[model samples]
Target: MTLTFASPDQPAIALHVIDQDARDGWLEAQPPQVQAWVAANGFTGALGQVLLIPGADGAPDRALAGYGTTDRRARVRFPLAAAAEALPEGTYAIASGLPADRAEIEALGWLLTGYAFDRYATQSAAKARLVAPDGVNAARVEIMANAEALIRDLVNTPAADMGPDQLQAAAEALAGEFGAQFEVTRGDALLERNFPMIHAVGRAAEQAPRLIEMTWGTSGPKLTLVGKGVCFDTGGLDLKPAAAMGLMKKDMGGAANVLGLARMIMALDLPLQLRVLIPAVENAVAGNAFRPGDILTSRKGLTVEINNTDAEGRLVLADALALADEGAPDLVISMATLTGAARVAVGADLAPFYTDDDAAAQALSQAAFQAADPVWRMPFHTPYETLIEPGIADLDNAPAGGFAGSITAALFLRRFVENSRYMHFDIYSWQKAKEPGRSKGGLGQGPRALLTALPGMLDL
Candidate 1:
């Protein structure tokens, strides 16, 4: 990973992180020359503002970063990352003014600023380097940063390069790296293995459909993560318009996110038996494509009527969730870029999740703020459960009327898991515009929050 810390013994410049409220007091403590330089530069501690001070030799001796006011800070995330981008190439150490409680998050933000997807095109690497701040877990920060990079890299790739086979390969590689047991059920084997919905949705694609599974950690609580791996969504026979099809390459973002979360879990050696399931497929159009009005039997024996083939993500995830539930893991969480309704409800910045478990919801909500990964707890409204049930079938893949689309989708997936505590994240997984630390490209949502919340949820 490109995101890393400078060597501890290296000579470094001091980075004075000044907030707007404390700017004047800080300036009074400085020498006359330093005070004069600060006034001349118009450094009032606005958010993201950076100014360099010269030494006796006339070279840059130290740097100042603005942390802005409380009101301004509440409006943005990764505030330090903005300053990290503007700083010149050098190793810097935090000198003063950083809040102790926010040290870990700010330190992580600095590392994230170094991420750039340079696989297909040559991209400039971040110039500024940081010394891991005191009291921050340097190894944990590194693991989170590397895992976020993995998610970004996978989602940014085009469908041509990130198809089912490629996704499977990525999972296999991850499993091998952590010495996890990896197994895959591919092509006709899915049919033999009773993943009929997975086979149905992917039958039209050139690449065969498959289920990718990885298991790690033999002790402690059992946790299973199911991610939707629709590599590309042409919307099937209910074809998406060109405008909507532009970013279909990120349809597998759910799978990318779970893999990233798994990386963090295994790297930290969390005391839990972790299982990951991804039903990899490409929803391409052809004669055999699962068409509208088609009724298919899922692994759980629930017959689902396809009202719109565009709603194919839930089909694959249903089969995977059913398989995960069969193991009766202590917790089963499904992450998917499944519904546009979720995006409309909370926009791109927040991950909206549905869960029946109040304890899980509370833990995730609290942890999300601490991790700086925003999440909203959406309910698995029991009253609307009937919306997914059409008279002709056990469930409707795409409910009619669309009053509560995201909720209905969550309810549909919830049907397959009868025994385990379940949670579902409906994530957009794309950053429409650039922000501090988060570039304008494929994005990862909810993973970091889940990482932080796991210990409390499982009592680890």
Candidate 2:
């Protein structure tokens, strides 16, 4: 399903806002046509409810979409989505009564209502065109929609068609499209490059695990993005049960989201030296699989004890983060489908990000609010550092206590990062169910927010 922006000569649809307290003169200021439409349809402004008034020829004339109150920002997005569902498959323009900046979000809403993941089945055609409002930034809206579509497509694809090698191809494709330099270090080369933790976690898979690196831009402050690219996590030696492993195909959602962000950055042509580091690996079970209670060396020269092989995202990320740290970029941010604890804490809609730098955290939070991407700030409590201490080694991959799992995971990744200002996002990449602009699949967590924030960060 696709949402087209149209400028047809077809009759326009007036969006009549319904108000419940009509007797108290709540809707006295409304136009006669709107008042008549409300009276004719018997519409009260209850949330999520909509009414269609018929024209003189007995065809649908205009729509009355109910809202809670005039002063509230309590508009229902799904009802707007239901407009896409209920309206006759054709183009429609909002005649009046919507805030100026909301057009972009409304366009996103229109596109989202038509999104369907039909990889294994046939898809039905979509028929809804939300006409762009005058003076609205249609190009920006289209860019965001395409970026989101890219992320959703990658995340929804099954592991059978998207593995480590395929992930590399995707990254390389992104680099090629943007005229960026791309490189990959695989198999024995990982060991040669001192990426021992990466080699240890991925040695069992038929596909040799590697790091995908791409660099774009030539000037301004350096920005590095690191994403954990575990394609299909079988939990390695400490394997997950069947139920727990069901959604493991989305393990590389971090990689998908970063690629989406890259698409936006290059599309907008942000002035910054952009670097992307993705440690692509498949944590599959095999004879040579790394097991629990094993000590592993890291590229950063930190000795790690594998308390559980399922915590392999951090391992692969450690090597990648070490490489990013080596460059000492001005800013480094890493995102991952790293832990279930994050979902337990913030649910799927709002991803939680951890950062030691207050200014960067504020900037990210501000960006999230401005873009409507919405990420919560998780504390980077330095006291939690003790939770990741290893008795036998320099650090333990999995902490003993289940409490503060997400915080501990952030602490674990922080061990490999130094010199650069860093932030970590422990994201539950998949959305459980569909919402206004979010389709029910692997969701793009931070790209939208970061894309909005990067241009100014690079002084573009």
Computed on alpha carbons, the lDDT of every model, listed in order, comes to: 0.93, 0.79
The deviation in Å at residue 180 for candidate 1 is 0.7
lDDT of 1 by residue, 363-430 (tens): 99999999999999998889998889898999999988978899999999999999999999999999
Residue pair clashes in candidate 2: none
Q: Give the range where candidate 2 is weakest over 10 consecutive residues by summed lDDT.
A: 17-26
- Who wins the TM-score comparison? 1
Report the C-alpha lDDT of model 2 over 193-239, residue by residue, as the tens digit.
88888888888998998999999999988999999899999999898
Query: For every model in order, what is the number of clashing pairs?
Result: 0, 0
lDDT of 2 at 141: 68
lDDT of 1 at 318: 96
Clashing pairs in 1: none
